[model samples]
Target: MPKMKTKSGAKKRFKVTASGKIKSGQAGKRHGMIKRSNKFLRNARGTTVLSAADATIVKKYMPYAR
Candidate 1:
């Protein structure tokens, strides 16, 4: 079989943590900050682990990320 081609966009957007969790930047911070509360901004400042269901999808795009 041929080697699988990793998704270029996924490789740049998602990261495989040391523990194997998929980490990506928090959502809802791209715009509309005026409507977003200070607490939300603070809490969503860094990357977050993708939910198990969501991680499964990302994993497909990054076969070798495991």
Candidate 2:
């Protein structure tokens, strides 16, 4: 049987941690920084774990991640 292919876009954007959580960069920071508040920028500075609903989708894209 053919091997399952991982989604290239998901591979670059999401990371599966050792404990099986998905780590991804903050969203909404690509443009319009001036319109955003300081607090939003501060809180979105680093990676955040995906919620259960989102992680399930990512898991399908990255079958070998776990």
Candidate 3:
């Protein structure tokens, strides 16, 4: 069987933690910060865990995660 390949885009976007959880960046952090409150921007700085169902799909693109 052929080796599974990682998706470059997915690799850059998602991260798999040591405990098997998927961590991702929050949205609305790139631009338009002038209108957004400091509190909102602060909250977006942390990583979020991907849900089980969504993680299953992402795992395919990130073969090494498993």
Candidate 4:
């Protein structure tokens, strides 16, 4: 059988950590920053882990990820 291909979109948008958690960037940090509050900006600075149920689905699409 042929090797599975990584989902390019998923590869760009989500990351798999060393421990197997799905890490993603915060939304709304790319544009219109002038209207956003400092708290909002600060909160958008970190990555978030996906829930277990959702991670299951994402892992299927990213079969090559660990």
Q: State the TM-score for model 4.
A: 0.76
Question: Which ranking of candidates, highest TM-score first?
Answer: 2, 1, 3, 4
Candidate 4 clashes between residue pairs 3 or more apart in a chain or in different chains? none
Worst 10 residues of 1 by lDDT: 24-33
**1 versus 3: better TM-score goes to:** 1
Clashes of each: 0, 0, 0, 0
RMSD of each: 0.9, 0.7, 1.5, 1.8
- The list of candidate 3 runs beyond 4 A from truth reads none
Question: lDDT tens digits, residues 1-66, model 1?
Answer: 998999999999999999999999999998899999999999999889999999999999999989
Model 2 reaches what TM-score against the true structure?
A: 0.95
State each model's CA lDDT, in order: 0.95, 0.95, 0.90, 0.89
Question: Candidate 3 at 65: error in angstroms?
Answer: 1.4
Using TM-score as the measure, the top candidate is: 2
Error of 3 at 46 (Å): 3.3
- Shift of residue 44 alpha carbon in model 4, Å: 0.7
